[model samples]
Target chain A: MKVLNEMSVNFESRSVNEAFARTAAAAFAAQLDPTVAELNEIRTAVSEAVTNCVVHAYRDTIGIISMNIRIAEGNILIVKIRDRGCGIEDIPRAMEPLFTTSPEDERAGLGFAVMQSFTDKLTVRSKPGKGTTVTLEKRLSPRLSDV
Target chain B: MLLKPKTMFDGKVLTVYLSGDIDHHSARRIREYTDALIGELKPVRLLLNYSAVSFMDSSGIGLIMGRYRMMKLYGGSVSVVSIPPALRKMMELSGLGCLDVLEGGNEENESA
Candidate 1:
């Protein structure tokens, strides 16, 4: 098959990245007759992840955020967002469902857990002085045969 | 309008820039727009621009990874850029960086 598809964005924390992610994912789901339940779950996961970044990632300063999405077929989809500001040195501690980097921010730290549950495949990468990217992949259920 | 797709394209690639929160309310929208772009524009490559994006959870990841696989199927590649620092570390700890992710639009090469 012909390959190579991509996109980019330059934005700051105030841009409402979570809203964008939801709209985009919902748009992608409409292509197939996604179940109402599935759609709801997906959108929630997106919001949770975005809120984490906005609430805890950027802090008080306005910073840049990037989100990328791909649909391989009618059955599977992928979405990833990355930013370079303050890297998370301890992922395990952070991924702990109840762990919050900033308790002062009232961050539940459940974002990662929720995202993991929603998507069939979830991956996160980062460097101390670099950035972090959250990648999620899912296989649509009740397949209709064409994607 | 439930979801309106806005795109940025280079002759060899196409990038869809999304904003706001990506949650149960909008995952499907992103999916449909992507399918249309791939079907109609038929660019040699496609990418999702998540820089301006502020929030996202697993549904967000689902959207990104799904697209990555899509581009891979066509032989093209998918990429993520400008992820915030704290969020970037989260992805790394989760091992989600196995794919393609770029820092600050550095135009460098990275993968999920």
Candidate 2:
């Protein structure tokens, strides 16, 4: 897909940045003229991804979390969040609903599930001790005006 | 930023009014404070008011599930009220509806 627009950002994996990252993703996605519901879905998906970096990836210490957002042809919004912290040993198990490693922290283990449900496509790639990258893609509905 | 919750207790019900965005960071504070109140008041019902919540992700679900478990341990019940449309969708996707904690409309009611 041809990238019409793109932006990249790197921030510390702090819990506070979770809100910032999601809001930033929504702002960047506004160029696609997504409806309120669409924008919210994007924001929610981004929040879950960033939160994983803060809570699980860099569990012991703070690390840099990188995000790349691109608006492609056909009003497709693609968001990629990556962390160079401890990678997931089991991607499938991690994505399973209600499966959380940190239950004591009150994690519902619904992050990946939420991301998958809110976005059209969700991709997760990780290698233990290497890193983890989560990509979310959504095709915004065509506006009547555009048609 | 973590916005403190406004809580009220009426003998049998402990109502917590949660506001602002509930992400991982804010959820921690809300959970701790709400749990402390639940432990102290030990009400028969725990009402979580989300009318003022502007945004929430899975962390909010965790908060509700934790509270549900906590209340169940004491034989109490947990109910979520005034959930926004976006948040209601999130709750449904997370299968929180089965718990039967979701109640009432999106607008904050005077009775609550």
Note the DockQ of each predicted structure: 0.10, 0.89
- DockQ of candidate 2? 0.89
Give stretches of model 1 more than 4 Å off: A1-10, A145-147, B1-112
CAPRI band for model 2: high
True contacts kept of 1: 0.24
Each model's lDDT comes to 0.64, 0.91
* lDDT (Cα, tens digit) per residue for candidate 1, span B15-65: 777765554336567777787788676677776766556555554665665
Clashes per candidate, residues 3 or more apart or on different chains: 107, 0
lDDT of 2 by residue, B1-112 (tens): 2657888888999989999899998999999899899888899999898888889999999999999999999999999998877787898887888888988575445344
Cα-based lDDT at residue A14, candidate 2 = 90
| Model 1, residue A139: C-alpha shift (Å) | 0.9
- Residue B46 CA displacement from its true place in model 2, Å: 0.4
Backbone clashes, candidate 1:
107
Candidate 1 residue-wise lDDT, A73-97, digit = tens: 5466677777776668888887887
Q: Tell me the spans in candidate 2 whose CA falls farther than 4 Å from its real position.
A: A144-147, B106-112
Best model per lDDT = 2
In terms of DockQ, the best-performing candidate is: 2
